[model samples]
Target: MEIKNNRLTGATFVEANAYNKTAVMKPDAIIIHYTAGASGNATVKLFAAKTSKTSAHFVVSEDGTITQMVDLNRKAYHAGTSSYNGRSSYNNFSIGIEISNPGYLQKIDGKYYTWWEVKKDKKTATPEDKVYVGKHRNAVTTMTYWYKYTDEQIKAVKELCQAICKAYDIKEILGHEEIAPGRKCDPGPAFPLDALRADIVSNTKKDLNVSELFKDAVKESASTSLTIGRVKVKLNFRQSPSSNAPLKSSPMAADTYVYIIGSDSTGEWYNILYEMTGWMDKEFVEQDNTDDNYDGELTTNSAMLYNDQKKSRRLVSDLKAGTKFNILDQQENMFRIQAVVEGWASSKYITKI
Candidate 1:
């Protein structure tokens, strides 16, 4: 598909022999999993093989590179016998992303099954080189296994979640264990579920109102302006909502600073600092600070001009002082004005009084 936005990417059609051709799919949920293989390449190869009887829509490597395996429109075999929110057969209607990791733990067998011991020989069983085995086992099964995912793997998964939430009208995200609680547990305790969910929910919620959320997120993520004379001064360090919180007070100047993030409808305050998000106070900032020198001479360099048509060249001799002009906008060297008087005195002669 054309990848209309940041939604899911098109599948690369790997190891798809087991996919149900008759299954109709419309993704409403996201299923996360871990490929308990030794390496990402090996995991990809395994899923790509036609005989594996299992496939995910995408496989994210430890380094955050994503490999697509199945088309978003078609069914992938990853979610076997899974259900969520009263819906069954999730494979027919969900995107599955298998993260590459060794899983919860690793297993190593010392002295490769001494042949003499296996044969019950009285002589001491000669030891052989230790053989490593994958320890991750099915929770429901009797076998014991261990595999550990790397930090990079977890970060990659979170980013992938953000991307997926951005693209689809996804209502909920799930771990494989959540979908098949009795059978699966690939994404173990190491996977930060709360943090991932927070990102997904935050991104998905923001996409519903790109402009508003962007503005709000921007305001919330950064400090707001305070009028000091005609200039809008920014706080040296953004403030937060609480008095005791490290972010609540500015370490720079102790002036009255407003937190931009906290002005949401909920009445909470937050401020953006270095692009990082934090809570702050709404009372400290004003949206339309009237004292912003609206009474000053409507000049071309007042910092409010926003268009190109008004900044055209004009001679300095054509502007008149008492002729009066409303400051529509002000920019670098030009001022956009709506003429209040018809007579022209001089062009470039216009100066802010």
Candidate 2:
């Protein structure tokens, strides 16, 4: 297939030297797993070893750093005996991402004891114990083995998954357990599959033809007044709506104004503005105010008296200002007013004075 986007960076690959070939397959799904190892480096070494015969496309560290062990085009040696949606050979068409974690269960008080240690019971055979030795029930020491994934790890996974989805036409993303079921459960219940899938779906929808949506928004925003404290703020321009793009120069000053050009939403980054337009913080621009005045008052006619036939008419201009007007009559749409200048000005400017 054509390389529309390349998001697989920071990944390391190992060719099947013995087979004298690499498993090149178009991935249809994303399989998530746990390393069952203490660290990402350990997982990497395990995959690198020729005898291990196990590897994944990516290995995410506890802090969420990603180490690629295989190329996306080539199949990684993960998902052994896995099936998804009634299909088999998952390793051939799935991208495997392994998170560094200790295996499902561990034994504490064992030779390899760490802060997060698992305890295992040592069996000793004696005369009395010999009877139960065949069915020995060793008293195991219990240590606190916490299964905590750091925030950084979660963030890294989210970014990586989004990038992958953008690069390939990958529609389905699943955990190893979900695909393999009875065979494996690396990415266990602790992983937020539902939340992750929801995010992926939302992002995919957003990425579809976002430029067009932005263009439409810009066209619709022409009539709207984008003001900051009565003066229009300058737009911080960008080549794309994404924040990752280099910042473009400000196009207008606080007093100058422009129309909205376009917008796109990428995860947390909302790209608004195009080359024809410019980027503006969503917080800065106020939507169009169609009303004539901010205070919501009505302009007046020649008379300034209360027209009992009609209703009330609000004084549009401040009465204390240089142009003063007397209330003759009030109407729904028309305002009757008699105006006089501050000093003895000319009556030419005033009507019904």
List runs of model 1 lying over 4 Å from the truth: 5-15, 21-24, 106-146, 208-353
- Candidate 2 wrongly placed segments (more than 4 Å): 1-7, 10-20, 103-146, 208-353
Clashes of each: 35, 26
Weakest ten-residue segment in model 1 by summed lDDT: 135-144
Residue 289 alpha-carbon offset, candidate 2, angstroms: 61
Model 2 lDDT, full chain set: 0.50
**How far off is model 2, as Cα RMSD?**
28.5
Q: How accurate is candidate 1 locally (lDDT)?
A: 0.50
List TM-score per model, in order: 0.45, 0.46
The TM-score, computed over Cα atoms with residue i paired to residue i, of candidate 2 is: 0.46
Least accurate 10 contiguous residues by lDDT in model 2: 130-139
Give residue 81's error in model 2 in angstroms.
0.7
Candidate 2 clashes: the total is: 26
Per-residue alpha-carbon lDDT of model 1 for 75-122, expressed as tens digits? 888877665433567777788888886553322232222222324543
